[model samples]
Target: MEAQQKIREQPVDLAILDIMMPGMDGLQLLKSIRGSHHFPVLFLSAKSQDHDKILGLELGADDYIAKPFNPLEVVARVNALLRRVHHFDVPAPPPEPEAKQLVLGALTLDLKECVLYVSGEPVMLTSTEYKILKLMMEEPGRVFTRKRIYEAVWEDFYMYEDNSIMVHISNIREKIERDSKKPEYLKTIRGLGYKINAPAEN
Candidate 1:
């Protein structure tokens, strides 16, 4: 508790915790940590069983090393995790499995920068909006079903709700379209969802 309190008081780059502790088992500790913020967690345990390893990963431990592990390997893994945590250490954009942009309709989305430019005009977008746009840009003119859009955006954190997807598309249209009601860029296909064109040039 004392160690955890001190660590929590400041930013934690990474965490190393033993699986079998006295009061709180490793899994319990992991839950406690996740209750607030997410960070890379490395589990070192004497229990080498595959089930234990699987449970550790399912619980959100980033890397798990079993007991009787080589010190050099543990050190190397720890360093690699640290590099990953710090190098690419940020929650991915709301919808992207990775940071990739799909330029469309005279717009460039620097997903890493989280910046969107439409016809060279800076357009601010929420994470949800960026995700919806990203999908449309990836496949120009291909209608994305509402269910698919919801699954792409909100399925990770909540039940698929088309209302949320519709809202995002509406917002994106307002930002990128010359007349959102007429929507020069993102077009709604009556019963289908929406799509954007990858600008005449990439």
Candidate 2:
């Protein structure tokens, strides 16, 4: 109760919670916290079962550490999470003087609402796909290596997750390209990465 109250009172930078608390368990508390806050939450629990750890993460815990853990390890993990959060704390940019849209031959990206348009037709995209396409569209014809795309969107270190990025690119192409097999905008730079091209003006 006091913990929740404190959170409601002032800004919280980070939180460390234990899973086996008395009345409101850590998982339940995390759920409640997530409804109102976006701070990083780490779980320190004696329940070392795989299910318990996975459940904690599934409920929004950033990191889970089992009991009998070294205090030094806890410190290290906390610092790492804080650093990751700090990296993403970008300030809002000044209002753009130009129009809030990016355009290629027939595709238009609404920067304000994060919408994509195909030949004047509205196209829907999953949040992940929208981000990937936006990144490439911002710098058309610039090849973006998978590692760069993964890190930019996922905000994590890339671990050779080629299939993950590949699947997303495929999905995006299906929505935006006239022919996914012979993509008009997205191109695979074999042995390198991927890039989105602006269609030549007709």
Candidate 3:
């Protein structure tokens, strides 16, 4: 109660939670506060099961670290998350007299506002998904290997977890693509990686 009150009173940039908290579990606390706080929350727990990690991510935790982990690794992960959030939070300089938005097909990405629009309709995206989309949009037609995508967006070394990248890509497509099964913008190059291609002008 005291800790929770302190969190409400203070300006918290991030939260590191243990899954085994007394009275209220971390996931419950996460559900309670996530709607109000947009800051990152990382889970540290002894449960190293894959399902545990997936559940944490699904419940809005930014990153999960299992127990028996090195303290330095935890610090590194915290720093990386903070850096990514800060990078996007910083306001860009005023747009040029004639500002240009990145356009790929019906999708438009406003670099200044860090927002995405599909056919002039706003599309909501999680921070991680937005970074991945931004990277691909910035370099249309270029294939981004899974490793490259992971490192660039997560700001961490890729551990060859293809599932993580695939999940985010699917989420992004569901939001922006009219038909995610047959995506027109984001495409997969079998055995190679993924790329974004601008639709040829009519």
Candidate 4:
């Protein structure tokens, strides 16, 4: 309660939470803060199980670091998360004059505003989800294997983290696809990976 109150009072750029806290667990704190805040949250927990990590991500945590983590690695992850959320890193120049708005079927992605619109209505997406969608939209019709997607968007080495990629993809589909089961734009290539259909000139 006291901690939450302090957080509410101060403007914070990021939050580092521990899962095993006395009285109220970190997950509970996360649930309470998430409603009003959109800042990045990282879980530093001893509960290093895969399910635990998945649960944290599902609950809107930006990243999870297990106990016994190297301090330098933790710092690196934190820096990466901050850079991603703040869009501080410079990207390579595009091949052509990038379109301000990318349209594919009913979906419209505003590259300048970093927002997604479905049928003229805005849709919310997490930073990770937006990054994935942006990558696909940038090069529609290009088959991006899971490894390539993870490496490109995460800017981290791909260690076969399938669940993390799959979960984010599922979330993106829920937001943009009229029927997630019968996705129109984002398509999966079995035995390969995924790709977004080429955007039609608007």
Candidate 5:
């Protein structure tokens, strides 16, 4: 608890914890942190079982390195994961369509934070709204079919529907745009689907 509190108070870029901690144990700590915070965690464990790796990964740990692992290798993997996640922290600008936020002029989509900002105002969104936005925001102006959007948000592919997507989009636009009907941020592509316009690539 002390270590975790310190981590929460300070800006911890990453946390390297041994699976066998003195008091709380690694898995419990990982679960707790994952539930409350979104910090990257690298698990160090002597258990080389595939099950162990799967458990750690399933628990939202950033990396699961076997004990006696090379420090250089661990650092490289951690750095790589950070680069991939951090570099794509914001929405991406699309080159194909006018739906790009970059093209639309001024909209901030913080992908990591799952936040939408228009002229510094916070545009509230739900989990579904944020996921859909993140997918389209990654490539603004790109027309994503309902199937694609469904797959992006939902795990079960067969049960996907367009209505849910539309509803989420409506909810999202209501929060972000001055006029939900004639949206500025989230826009429809007629026969196609929804797009966000240059969102946040970098």
Candidate 6:
């Protein structure tokens, strides 16, 4: 009854009950608690009361510890149960939506409208040029070899030809760069490959 009153008076994270208490036994107290409360309940019983422990579980007890148990073991079990309750009670965060635009320096590629903006000015792009620019913008600072660029944008196996890729890179630089001769965004990586370099933050 005292336990019941304490539970009613305040919110309880857990309840510990001995199966052989005076007047209202632990089993009876658990039954009363189950009627109106949902906090975790643990049963304490003598090894001889193994049957009572099983019965306590069927009557809605979360766990049971034998009488000859170590105090540390009981404390460990209680902490584990409370950790589970705390973990499960938390709400999961909502997933974020996929990005619809890619940006590098003054360039902004809108995936939905298939448009590229240079310093807030709309720049027209051919389908092939757009595909090439979009791929580089997706992963800024990562170098892309001529073969990789050709295979990705054209969706065909690349031969040892470099003119197509070179022409496209030149055209893109003419459109997005402040000076095609001294390109700021599209950079030649000297015997390696090309990459879109975002301007350093001021």
Best candidate (score: TM-score): 4
Clashes (backbone N, CA, C under 3 Å), per candidate, total 1, 0, 0, 0, 10, 0
Ranking by lDDT: 3, 4, 2, 6, 1, 5
Better of 2 and 4 by lDDT: 4
Per-prediction TM-score to the true structure, in the order listed: 0.47, 0.53, 0.76, 0.78, 0.46, 0.50
Local lDDT at 97 for model 6: 75
Which sections of candidate 2 miss by over 4 Å?
Answer: 1-99
Write model 2 residue lDDT over 67-182, tens digit each, in one string.
99999878876775665453222344567776488887788988665668999998855445667788999999888998998777656667544255676677778878888999
Candidate 5 to truth, TM: 0.46
lDDT (tens digit, per residue) of candidate 1 on 32-125: 7756544567889998887777666555566577788899877866765565443223545456556666676578887575568888887755
Tens digit of lDDT per residue, candidate 5, span 65-142?
A: 787898887766576445434332234445443332321446676653555677777665434455666677678778
| Candidate 1: C-alpha lDDT | 0.67
> Which is superior by TM-score, 4 or 6?
4
Comparison by TM-score, 5 against 6, better one: 6
Q: How far is candidate 3 from the true structure (C-alpha RMSD, Å)?
A: 3.5
For residue 48, what is the lDDT in candidate 1?
81
Task: Report the candidate with higher TM-score, 2 versus 5.
Answer: 2
Pick the winner on TM-score between candidates 3 and 4: 4
Q: Tell me the lDDT of model 4 at 75.
A: 89
Query: In model 5, which regions exceed 4 Å deviation?
Result: 84-112, 115-202
Instruction: Output the worst ten-in-a-row residue range by lDDT, candidate 5.
Output: 95-104
What ranges in model 1 sit over 4 Å off? Answer: 1-101, 156-162, 198-202
* Tens digits of per-residue lDDT for model 4, 1-202: 7879888787667789998898789999988866666567889999989898888877767778889899998887787667676641134345556658888777788866567899899886666777889899888899999999877776777764547777777777777777788877788899899999843456
Model 4 poorest ten-residue lDDT run: 87-96
